[model samples]
Target: MQTIQTDVAIIGAGSAGLPAYRAAKAAGVSALLIEGGPHGTTCARVGCMPSKLLIAAAEAAHAAAHTAPFGVHVDGVIRIDGREVMQRVKSERDRLVGFVIDSVNSIPSGDKLSGYARFIDNGLLEVGGHTLVRARSIVIATGSSPVIPPQYRALGDRAIVNDDVFEWSDLPRKIAVVGAGVIGIELGQALAHLGVDVTVIGARGRVGPLTDPVIKAYAEQTFRKSFRFEARATVESVVREGDEVHIGFRNEAGALIHDTFDYVLVTAGRKPNFDRLALENTSLVLDDQGVPVYDPLTLQAGKHPVFIAGDANGVLPLLHEAADEGRAAGANAARFPHVTPLIRRAPISVLFSDPGIAMVGARHGDLKPGTFATGEVSFEDQGRSRVMLKNTGLMHVYVDRQSRQFLGAEWIGPDAEHIAHLLAWALQMKLTVDTMLEMPFYHPVVEEGLRTALRNAVAALQAAELQAA
Candidate 1:
């Protein structure tokens, strides 16, 4: 029973914990990181990286399929070896894991231990066997786990989650995805392109409902063509019968339908992973859903010197937001005054589906009447967009009509993720529309779309003024 003392003990060596480890060490604080699993977080392992690989393979297959129509025909000789593709995916995943390990190992005074850790008392954690660690402060960055509905949990090898999708050596023949959120839609489309009969079921109006409606419409349009997009539909149940998985769902029309598939993937949502942490002994506040409650500004739990960040805090579950929260908590825990700025700069959320969706600053409902105005330009009109063959999709800009400051922007089409950062930076800097519209951008680029969207906003302001006068 060796007892070790440290200045800080950080739990979970994912995105948030990794950054917190480095920052704490830089601030001259000795920290210990405890992880139950691997080094990299969800984004590196299960979430962003693997999903994007699936999407890239899907896009390549789509291009190969369309090559015949563009005068380059391979004449009936094309095949995708699922096993080989999966091997490549694993290679990429391993490379990212190596990168994370290198970064974490670079922290001078940070230590990582592998085992499920539990809170013994205030600022005390028990890892592995009798190794007790006591610190002045504790940071919980345990992150999240995939959501599996009760009805589908019994199907062992037939039903899967996004986390297990990468482990399959072969793609499913017919698959049913049980959520229309970011993960489900992205993976569903990718599988559909890989020759899988993919059907998506969701009790929502559209895919990626949290995104701007305009962006949602674009995703719905693009994805519906390849996969069965069943919106406002509820999945009744899924049962494994023989070698197939049987799925039942009720559509918006209240009609019960049944289908059989080789696999069924559930991506409803993710909740915090705190079951084994033994938080009951400590004063960490937990919500009804078992998620830790922490002050968003300080990332500190209400009762103890312990802090929670990332998905554990449940403030904004995105990876970037979690990293920002972790950095702030680590810096402040080392006696530096922490500031949680009023996220006036809208953090852009991007869904990298076939036609990517990007939204910055404020959603449509976040703006106030008379304070803000919106202007949009269709992707059909942009020369660069036309060349890319994306004649659909929309780009929307929100502006403070009175102050002429750009509030935010959202776009769904090519280069959306890269284009979104410009608007986010502008909103963060409180830049006026006049300032944005004056900046010069290169021609025949998606960036020019930003300038065009801002120009349209300026035109709308002028029209409003003329009518008022």
Candidate 2:
């Protein structure tokens, strides 16, 4: 068995692990990065990049088909070649994955270990069966994997997960999507637009990461138009019948429903990948869900030299959050024994569905009614939305009633991702509602919709003050 020594050892080389390795090296610490899976991060391979590529193709096909509304009639029928689409998506996805792989290869061959790492003892790790890594500090950034229920697993090849969905050379003509979260909704809608008969089922009545009731309602209305959606649904069973899969579920009203499809895609959620890491060998204590209890600010695991970052922390699963957490964890790990406090970025989440959904900072339910005021604008008739023919959905901004500080926002509208970033930056900078309202809003732009929501928040606050007096 080969023995290796390093100042810091990073497990998983995905989004978080890579950054941690770089940060530790930048801190003048000898770092060893170990990865068991493919070199490309989840985002580049199966999560974000390929999904968006599929969505973009779906959007183009949908747009070409709907050009009649713009008085641009096509003489021939527009078609989507599923095989070609998937092939192109794979080609481009591989290109992006290659970049990350190249970056990993650039590291000294001796410093990179290609294997699964398990904790043997504090600051000691066993890699793949051969190499033993002894380090002063460790960073666990193993990330997460899709959660597959026993029922779905029983169906085997009949049911697919996000990872399998992207690799398919040809998509089924009809499919059932379980769990109306980010993955389900995005892929469900895109598939529907791409000429597939898609039915989406959600255990909860809401879709995406929506917590704001107003935004949730708007999202439901907007998305239901593109695909068949059933919420508050409970899957009873899944069975394979010849070439198709039959799914049984109970609707919100207690009515049993059954459907047969070419395939079933499960996107319930993701679980941390630390189960294989033998964390018990370390001093870290895991919660009931098998997540390490760590400080969000420092990403440290208790008082030990071990640190947790990215999806492994099970806090925020977004790509950007994972990267930031990795950097902090690496820096802290490199500087262990002499700790430095770090502040994490404000939370931001986006679902890349048409009339996208985004949540920035505090959610609507998190705010106390009387202490916080809300402002809203409906995109149903917003100029830009109307011009783009996506004139549906709403935007809501929450502010502190007294200080009028921007607390957070949730929206379902055209370019919600971009709009959410604007609000995220404002909230991070502690911009007040008044200052946001005073900023100039461009004409015929989606930002005007945000400006209107800010104005509404201010008005609501003033009205509340009048009522109190």
Candidate 3:
């Protein structure tokens, strides 16, 4: 076996790994990047980019067919070519993947290793019996993989994950998506808009990432009107009969429903790729979820020289979070024993569904009772929303009752992606509800709804103050 020594070793050359490698190199340390699989990132390969491409196609079809309100008439049926839709998705997906591969290829050939690595001991790695690396520090940026429930295993070829969706040459006629999280809702609704029979099943009455009960319920109701959405579902059996998959479940209303679909798409969740790393050989402390107990600020795993980042850390799995975590971990690993904590940005999440869903700063469940007041707005009556014929949405802005500062928000509304960013900035800046109301609001725009929500919050705060007095 070949023996090598490096200052830092980064496992998995995906989103987090690439940035970690760069940050360590920038810190004037010799770094090695190892990959056991494809070089493309989850976002570029199967997560964000391709999913958005598919959603774009879905949006186009939906727009064309639903223009009757604007008095625009299409005499004939609007036809969508499944082949063409998939062709664009695959073509654009490959282009995005190619760019990432190019970036990976630019690394010095000697610094890149093509093998899965396991910890033989703290800071010691064994790579496929071909190489033994002794590193002063290591960063685990190994990303994650789809978690397939045991029940779905019986479906055989009829069951698939998000990674398998972009590879299809043609879209299926019917698909039942299990788990109504971000991935499931985005894809399920997109497929439904594309003329497929889609049913999205959720458990525990959750929908997307919204924790606010009102917003969650509103989102559930709105989506059900668009497609068959079973919130708070209890799935009983999953079986494969020849080419089709049969699913039986009790929905929210306690109705036992049986359905057959061409495929069962599993979007339950993802598992971090740390289990294969032989962590027992290392002295890092792990949590109940089997993830390393790392400091979020420093990305350091306990008292060890190992750092965990990205989806491997099992904390925020989004691409931006992965990049930030990777950079922090790599820099800290390079300057071991003198690690610095990162000043993390305010939390923000968005789902690119129709009437986009977004959560910024703290979640609704995280707020302390008697410490917060909420402001709400309904787009159904908002001027610009009605004019655009996209007047279906609900938003709630949370504020500190005492300090009157913006705390967080949950939203399902038009232009939420943009509005969420504004809210996130307000949270990071610690802006007050009164202060946000002072910001300029343009007339006849979606953003006007935000102003309305803020004003509503101000009124609520006053009402609470009066009752207290």
Who wins the lDDT comparison? 3
TM-score of each model, paired residue for residue = 0.93, 0.98, 0.99
Order the candidates by lDDT, highest first: 3, 2, 1
Instruction: Note the residue pairs that clash in candidate 2.
Output: none
Model 3 ranges with Cα > 4 A deviation: none
Give the residue spans of candidate 1 off by over 4 A. Answer: 105-110, 209-211, 336-346, 466-469
Estimate, for each residue in 50-152, the C-alpha lDDT of model 2 and write its tens digit.
9999999998998898888889898887878999999999999999999998998899997799889998998889999999999999999999999988888
> In model 1, what are the clashing residue pairs, if there are any?
346-361
Backbone-clash count (model 1): 1
Please, what are the lDDT tens digits per residue for candidate 3 over residues 233-295? 999999899999889999878889999999999999999998779998877787787888889
Q: What is the lDDT of candidate 2?
A: 0.89
What clash pairs does model 3 have?
none
**lDDT-best of 1 and 2:** 2
Candidate 1 per-residue lDDT over residues 345-417, each given as its tens digit? 2677888876677778777767776677677777777888777665556788988878988877767777887
Local error of candidate 3 at residue 425 (angstroms): 1.1
